[model samples]
Target: MRIALIGQPNCGKSTLFNQVAGYKAETGNFTGTTVTFTESSVRVGGETIEVVDLPGTYTLAGTNPAEREASRYLLSEDVDLIINVLDASHVAQGLELTIELLAMKAPVIVAMNMMDEAARIGIKIDGPALQEKLGVPVMPLVASRGRGVKPLFLAALRMGKKKNPDTSNYLKIKENDRMARHRLAGELEREFVKRGDRRVSKRDRLDDFLLHPFWGYIGLIVILYTFFQIVYGLGVLIETPLLAFLETITSQAATYLGEGKLFTEIVIGALQGVIAGLGIVLPYLVPFLLGLGLLEDIGYMSRVAFLMDALMHRIGLHGKAIVPFILGYGCNVPAVMSTRTLDDPKERFVAAALATLVPCAAILSVVFGLVAFYLGPLIALILYLLNIFIIALVGRVLTAMIPEDTPGLILEIPPYRIPTPRTVVQKAWFRIKEFLVEAWPLLIAGSAILALANYFHAADFFNTLFRPITWTLGLPSATGVPLIFGIFRKELSLVMLGQALGSMSFDTVFTSVQMITFTVFVMFYIPCLATLGALRRELGTKDMFSITGLTVVIAMITALLARGVAMIFF
Candidate 1:
């Protein structure tokens, strides 16, 4: 049997999905669209079932890709039952989608998620009354804390087994248009939910400080600074000992195998790539993702969007663009995919382009591994600030050239919840698994390929091809191949640089100026292979080429400026 999970954005549908699916779900696109959904096989009530978590949509008939995707999948004959997740605090809006889903005549059950948030504001929901009104089971749940999870799935399981479900009364109400559903939703809310003595909660008061005009920006800076320190500190603790441990093994093996032989070089080179992913990339990446997950789970991310909305306007973007930027820090593929959420095509293009400039976690590994690991955290932080300044300038220029009149940001600010360790770890692992599965293999293969090129004396060709560019930047010509390969995987560039320079300890071969300039260039250059595919699907082939060219120009200009500045100081 199959169950489909559906809800509007910020309605806790995804949280509920994660509660049950955990890290076992696989994310992919539907058969014909670029729109993505998650699915996992789970056993409930002694029966294994497939649960599909569709993209968040406000209405079935909406024009956006996600909305259309949701509508198509829900209407398909394959869905046995529909689990409509509703945000308990936002009763009316949740019912808007619920009424429409019921119209399809699928076996439907309502999962009222985030019930604690509803109660904290003194809002009372009669679940039994709602179930009576909708003519379907309504399950109360707190997904983050795992409350009522088993009962909810068990209810869904039992309902799935019934050939004739109890949803006939809901099917009687005609849900023809958006306005009709909207009205019906409001009517249902009036009958079922009671608003009592409202309390001003601590989260509401905390937002006063977090969303303040002046103090908010200061807090953003401090929070970001502290985040970097925690990740870097954790990375150092692991990376130092891990790299030291690998160095001993690889060195002893090199002497045993005889350093210059082809077989020996291939084995050591491939192992070094594995070493880089384990010792270099993962040290910073694991903690970075974990910290990022905590920020997102606790809901400070929305406050950031609210605070930055004004400043974003100056750059011809809105606070909503911050969504892609935040995700970009984790990986650019999802960041590019997120641009689809915007209504305006021009805004999507502009946001997608600028998001590429936001260094991804792989490029982040390059930053911390090289800059923070060697130069110190202060300079690394400065480099990040400089990258942001460059992105804002590029946004302003792109918006000026496009010259579109776009709408202001209309976004929901989800109430803050105390994060659970289990939820946070699941979120982090979900993201980090992509690195281990996709990029780690490429890192190993690319390292071995570069080793073969070196053993065969073919590295000179790539270096010569990139000679003019490297000569212009006053960097060694041999640095060219790594930069070219960065278009494949950004972290590969860092690893290959270690190979080209004959040391994973970068400071041994390059001066402070060389390292800073090389990193700046890598930070802003072409998007990786996966991100390029996402951009093509989102903005078309022409814009992909345009954005790729734009990044190259931005990279060259920024690197030269950094090179000049570093030379004077160093």
Candidate 2:
């Protein structure tokens, strides 16, 4: 049997999905469009059931891309059962979506997630009464704690086995009537929900300082600074020992192949890239992703979007664009895919365009490994700030050219809660493993290819081709090689840089000014090939090429500007 999990945003649907599915779900496209859903398999009743976590939507009739795609999927009737998750603490608002889902005439088991929060707020929900009224099984769960999730799935499995499951009479009578559904939802809320006196809670207390206009911005800076320290500090602590161990092993192997044969050189080159990825990049990425995951699970990310919405509008984007922009810091692939949530196509295009320029973990690894390792952390921070400025400027220009109506930011600020350590670790590890599985093969192959090109004098051809541009930016001809390799993977460019210079110490090959300039260029240049594919899917062929070309121009100008300023200082 096939199962679909649907809910309104911030209703804990994703939390429940992750708890049930583990880290096994893959992002699947919806009808070959840019929109996507998470899919996995769950074993129930001695049979494997395919489950999909549909994109969250407040209504089936909404025109947003997520809603449209979800509506299309529901109409196809491919799903055997739907598990409609609701925020138990706010069932009145959540039941509106649940009512709409019930109208589909499919078997649905309501998962009233976050019962703990509901209880804390003194909201007493009679689960049995809700089940009796809805005419379907209603299960309460605190999904974040793994409480009641198994029972919820068991209930879904049982419902799936039935030939024809009955829905609420309210759904049956008002399947096509929006007003009637709303009225029915309100009636159900009054019938099942018993509210207590309003009281301030821990989340409410934190929000007082976190959402304050003046203090909130200061808190954001402090949080970001602390985040940077954790990622970089932990990465350095781990990278030092790991790189030492790997260098010893690889150096011994290199000594064995000291004859300088072409095959020997290729083998060493590939090892170097592998070492760089494992030793240099993964060390930083794991901690960075862990920190990012913690912020997401703690609900701070939404607050960031709320805080940045004003700034986003000034650049022709809105608060919604911040979701993709922030996700871009982890990986641009999902970030671009996430643009599907934005209702405006013009805004989606602009957000997608700027998201490519946001320095992802891969690019950050390169920045830290090269710039911070040789120059200082301050320079790395400067490069990051510069990237943001470039994104804003580019977004402003794009907004003027393709003007469109942008809706005000309408977002949910989910209550902050302490994330389970196990979930955070698992989520971080999953992302790291994904990076290794997808990028390693390409990195290893690219290393061997670049090594062969150097051995065969192909570097000279690329050098001559890129000389005018590289020279204008005050970069060496040899720098052209890594810039080209960066298209495959941003961090690979740094690995290739080590191979090109024939040393791990970058200071010997370039001055401080050149290092700064090169880092700036790498930061703003083309999105990695994976991100390019995502952008192509989201923006189509013409826009993909347009974005790619535009970033290249921006990179060149920025790099030259950095070099000019650096020369004056150094």
Candidate 3:
């Protein structure tokens, strides 16, 4: 039996799915669309059953891609039974969707998740009463702590055994109108849910500080500052020894290869790429991805989106646009694809453009591995700040060109939960695996290709082609080739940089001003080829090229200005 898990965003649907699916879940898109869902198989009663977790949707209104995807998958009749995961603390909102699902003519088992949070708010839900009212089994679940997981799935298994379980008998008022269905949801909530004196919980007090108008932004800064500090500290601790080890090996390999042959250069160049990948994954990318996972699992990311909303408006977009920006930190491909969730085309375009500037993990590897390690975190932090300022400025310009009414933010503020180590590690690995699988082999080949190009003296041709950019930005003429390779994968730029410069160590080669300039250029240059494909898929080819052009111009200007500014300090 195939059971589909459905819920609104932050309803603990994903947490519940992960509780059962563990680390082996497979995430894939529907056959022809960018909309993704996760699926896994679980064993229950000695029978293996397939379980699919659909994208989160507020309703079956079909207003957005996620909602539409949810609508399509649920209506397809492919599912054996539906597991409607609901946030027990906020049942009324979830019930609105539930009412829509009941009319869909499928068997459903309501998994009332976050029971602990509901209790903290003094919410008393009569589970059997709700089940009786809806004519579906209602299982209380605290998925985060592994409570009620077995019973929930067992109940789902029992419900799934029936060939065609009827869900329509209880609520015969299957009103098709949206507002009327909403009213029915409220009525059901009123009947089944009770509230007593709300306990003064620590969560409430914590929110008071975290969501405080004055101190909230301060807290965000401190949180991010310390967060990066930890990532940098951990990264450097690992990087120093690893780089020394790799460098020692590279030196030995160079000696063994006897310096001047073409074959030797190619072998050493490939090794640099391999070393760069390892250096990046172990030192910077792993820690960064892990920290990002921890924050997301802890539910702090929602607060970040909320906090960034007001600032988002200044750029002529709403808080929702921040989702793409947050996703951009992991990879620009998904970030670009995620722009489909924004309501306005102009907003989507603007969000997609700005997301490309958010610096993916590859760029983070460059920033932390190179700049943060060589210059200092202070300089690196300044670069991040400047990148933000640049994004806001660019956003204002883009939105002004294609004017539209900015939508107000309508975001859910989920209760903070302690992150689970298993989920956190899984999420981190899920992202890291993308880099390892998709980008590493390319890094190796590209490095060897660059070595061959240099050996044959053809590197000069490519360097000359981009010399205008390097020259105008006050960088070494040699930086041209790496910048070009960067279009394939941002990490390749660093990999190729070692080949182009004929050394792995950057400090001995570039001045502080040169380091700042080169890094700044990489920061804003063309999105990697993968990101370009995503932009093309989402925004079309013309706009993809336009955004690509915009990035190169931004890079040249930003890098030039950075070079001048660095002259004052260093």
Candidate 4:
């Protein structure tokens, strides 16, 4: 039997899924985590049943791809039962979705999730009365803490047993009953929702200050600054050991090869490629993923999104775009996928294009390596600010170009909670696993291709071919090779840079101004192969090539201008 879980965004659908499935699916306060359907099996009544968790949606009428996907799934997919998770604190909004779901005539068991939070907010739910009114079972649950979950699961099992059930009887409402339904719902809410006796404390005051518009911006900036600081410090702390470990492996491999031409090439080349790629990636990627996972599990990401909504609105995107932008910091592929949350196609396209401007894990890893080895943390922070500036500028341009109306913010801001260690580790592990599964093959293939190119001197050949442009941009001929490889993989640029400039310190090989110019050029260059592939699939080949051509031109112009200024100043 198949039981499908569905709900509006941030309504604890994922949390409930995790509870019943006995698996850890990362639950974030933000919308759109489950872009694709995730399935697991759970044992209930001594029988195994498959449970599917669909992406969160605001309503059946939503135009966003994720929402449309969920709505389509409900209409087309054959399921034994539907478990509709709702936020107890926001029943009015949650019930709107329930009403729509009922219209589909599917057998639904309502789970009013986050009951603990609702009670704290002086809101309550009369499960029995609500069940009687809707003619469907209502179960109150706190999925995060494992509260009232058993009953919810049992109810789902019971509901699933009754196939081809008469849902019409459950949803029998008069055509002119809008006013009566509203009044009934309001009366039930008034009777059941009891005010809590607990008074607001100092921590609540602190929360108020932090959540205020003016102070919230300050807090966001501070949080972002601290995040970078942690990333930098952790990078430095881990780099020396990582380098040592790679060097030991490389030395061992060098000895094993014993200078045979073919063996030496394969072994040393592979070692150099791995060290150049993995060594740089592991340090920053590990910490960054863990930090992000912790923040997400603890619900702080919603606050960040809420704070950034005002700025996002200026770009004709909703506040939820912040989640994708943040995910872009980890990888642009998922970030592009996350753009499915934006209801407007124009907004989705613009968001996907501009999201590419946000540096991903590979770029951040390279930045950390460059900063620690050459530019220092302060300059790294400055580059981060510059990145944000570029993203905002690009967003503004895209918004003006596309000019589509986007929906206003209607997101639920989940209260902050301490992330359990088990939850955090589970989420981090899942993310790391995902990264490895999706990116590792690409990294390995890219490394081998780059090694072959260097072995056959194809890279050198390209450098010579692009000599005129390289000279014009004030970059050494060797820089062209890395720039070309960067189009395939951004991290490859760093690896190639390190290999090409072997034994030469960045400070000695290039002036500080030139290094800065190179970094800026790399930052603005064409999106990597994976991103380009996604673009092609999403926006068509013509649009993909157009964007690629535009990015290349912009990169060249920016590099030239930067180099000109650098030459004049330094």
How would you encode candidate 3's per-residue C-alpha lDDT over 221-331 as one tens digit per residue? 899878768877897799889989999999899899899799999998889778867876787768877887788778787788788888998987887787677667756
**lDDT comparing candidate 1 with the true structure:** 0.83
Candidate 3, 174: how far from true, in Å? 4.4
User: lDDT (0-100) at residue 536 of candidate 4?
Assistant: 61
RMSD of 1: 4.1
What does candidate 1's lDDT look like per residue over 1-570, in tens digits? 999999988777777787778467887777766577888898887789999999989889888778988899888758889999888888999998888888785788899988987887788998898888888889999887789889999988888888877666773465478888888889888999997665677876887788777887899989877887887788768877898899899989899999899999999888877886686356776787778778877888777878889988988988877878876875676678667767788999999999999997688889998999999999999999999999999999999999978878888887887777776776667556555665566667767776787789887898899898888888988798888877765766788899777899888888899999999999999998667767887888899999999999999999999999999999
- The positional error of residue 47 in candidate 2, measured at the CA in angstroms, is 5.4
Please state the error at residue 387 of candidate 4 in Å.
4.5
- Range of the 10 consecutive residues with the lowest summed lDDT in candidate 1: 166-175
Minimal lDDT window, size 10, model 4: 25-34
- For candidate 1, the per-residue lDDT at 167 reads 66
Name the regions of candidate 2 deviating beyond 4 angstroms: 25-27, 43-48, 164-170, 245-281, 323-343, 359-387, 421-441, 474-478, 485-519, 528-542, 562-570
Which is the better candidate, 3 or 4, if ranked by lDDT? 3
